[model samples]
Target: MNDIRVDIDPALLTHHVERLGELGELPGGGMARLQYDSSWAEAQDLVATWMREAGLRVRRDAVGNVFGRLPGTDDSRTILTGSHIDTVPEGGKYDGALGVLAGLAALRALAARDERPQISLEVVSLCEEESSRFQANFFGSRAMLGLVGQEEPRTLKDADGVTMAEAMVAVGLDPAAVATAKRDDVAAFVELHIEQGKVLESAGVDVGVVEVITGLIWEQVVVTGRQDHAGGTPMDDRLDAVQAAAEITAEITRHVAGADGAGRVTFGRWDVRPGWPSIVPGEVVLSMDLRHTDPADLRKRATEAREIAAAVAARRGVEVTFERLKDETPTRMDPWLRQALADAAAVCGATSMGLPSGAGHDSQLMGEHVPAAMLFVPSVEGRSHCKEEFTRPEDCVRGATVLATALHRLAY
Candidate 1:
């Protein structure tokens, strides 16, 4: 296992990346291949074609997860690799796409070897992770883990008021059979991705072995107040919901910022009812996204956030309520698998280090069900989730080689 190594073609990786990056490119700038959209479907079909060219059998599950399989001598259990295929609205090219490409490249290299593995190897292009089009985050991984709610397909709607079920049907997928996507044969899983931060690049490292993934809490805060004409309502008499909401968000941000830089809070979305300059807003709806590496600290911050909102609302004479949209605890990677990835990096002559992932991923959900781990390459200038996001080509090839080497150790 220590001696295991696999060569990845740099040109092949570059070519696939350029082709995939072109699918959902937006007119203004970045890409947006939202889940089940036309561009997303086209990208999946292209990946399936690449899988077939790489000498693997390809199939799509009921939830639209595309898998490419290389059968082994003993096929009862499988080793799974790859990541989600979906991207955020106007998202960069490498975020989710690179992991899928790395897995494909790894499988391609392994296929040319003389000896077959003792367990099946499979790569998946998960249907959704960004939740850019719908609010169902990790929908693909949840289906595989048997965590998706039965009514989600009919209930979850996109920005355009289209239900997930309708979108699935449009893509020729039967939402009624979502349960069929569950799999119990996966023995282990590994995902290779870009760091999406400056951790590795700042340290001048070649790759990163993810030690843990941060916990996240998403809450929707809604404030209600009296509506009146902006000109007639006195500043002191007006119970402005937007003002209260803004204060609440500002207080939360201050608290998180004052703490060690490890904790993060964001008010990414907000809406003011009767959005007019001449109207005193009667209702305000805002999103609070909180994250921390420590589970206890994460919970503490969430509690503090709620308390702060309630206090501010009381003082401001407005009614505030919170709805918990999502809550995910911190996830630790499998130690043995982390060591394996580090060893693989060493074998591939790439420097490696351990770090925690601040962003959410399909791996966080998958790790709870299987022995899972992640490998991360550098993102130049720590830029991600935007058009300026980039990773050097050599770093990309090195990461793929490390992934292939790790797969060789586990599968063979």
Candidate 2:
């Protein structure tokens, strides 16, 4: 039984969070620190400085994944912690920032006590996870795991037509050396993040021990039909792509609702070609985002979704094509690490419940190479990726303490 007490300073956490927020402050009280941007550069430098101030050895990988290392009695294996630092456009101040700040505070608390563990501890401020720029989510995590594809740098593009390669260089990183970023010394991983949903808050729980990360399926649907003059075509005679698309979208939503958590389906983005009041739409392209915690259920839902689309297209006399944009399997947390977090939460006098993460995270990628677990704090109103997102200071402090205690137990 280890007797390490966490000495986290609330003021230090708040100060660092405020200072980091200043780098990418938007006009409307939000943050916009996209990857490889100038604001991201400044924020990275600031966090690196804090890591140094905490008496840790700090360094960056080839893809700009910053790490702070606290050496232990034996440095052969390491316990890794922390989260991403990038923010979505018009995103809130506390999404990824909280996790990184908490890691810093926890490490600093342990250092103040002059405690050493059996294994080294590291805090990583992962470079890219939001995909706000290149549609390359988990870029830093994937690079660290050697999961990045060779074509990613040349193919992915931002709204400004900037390639990932270009963005990397703009931030003083080399695209060719991405493979060198993979590390095999990590023994375990823990990430502390906001719930980003109202579950924990509504349940009156102080912390959430994540059990699984939901799997996702993204599809691009295209429906083709004959275009005709609105006045010249009768209601029954016209083969309308827009009409077919609308029917398919409605059916998809309805099926998801009836699936009993089989999965979630969303038709969030749509584009209808040749917008004109007098002309019928000839083509419709839309994006479908679906997710499920159960792999079998996810497969069933995806199959049903495609079948529904095909049925609708056939009945409406339109040609439909479904192209998969992204597909990711669900990831389960390490059982031993989960128990460690549960024990730490009890020690901190915080009630915790096991929950599933509805949103994707870098932890999903890290889990591929190392044993990983995550801690989640409640989000106010279950809101995230928006300007209105917030987490109470007390909740933040409690979560950080739990993280510190857990890390201490694991390393010591």
**Candidate 1, residue 246: lDDT:** 90
Stretches of candidate 1 off by over 4 Å are none
lDDT on C-alpha atoms for all candidate structures: 0.93, 0.90
Clashing residue pairs found in predicted model 1 = none
Q: Could you tell me every candidate's TM-score relative to the true structure?
A: 0.98, 0.95
lDDT of 2 at 276: 87
Query: Which candidate has the top score in TM-score?
Result: 1
Candidate 2 lDDT over 189-266, as tens digits, reads 899999999999999999999999998988999999988899999999998999999999999889988988647888
Model 2: how far is 149 from its true place, Å? 3.1
The residue ranges of model 2 lying beyond 4 angstroms of the native Cα positions read 228-234, 276-278
The pairs that clash in candidate 2 are: none
Cα lDDT tens digits for candidate 1, 44-100:
999999999999999999999999999999899999999989998878999989999
Model 2, C-alpha of 29: deviation from truth (Å): 4.0
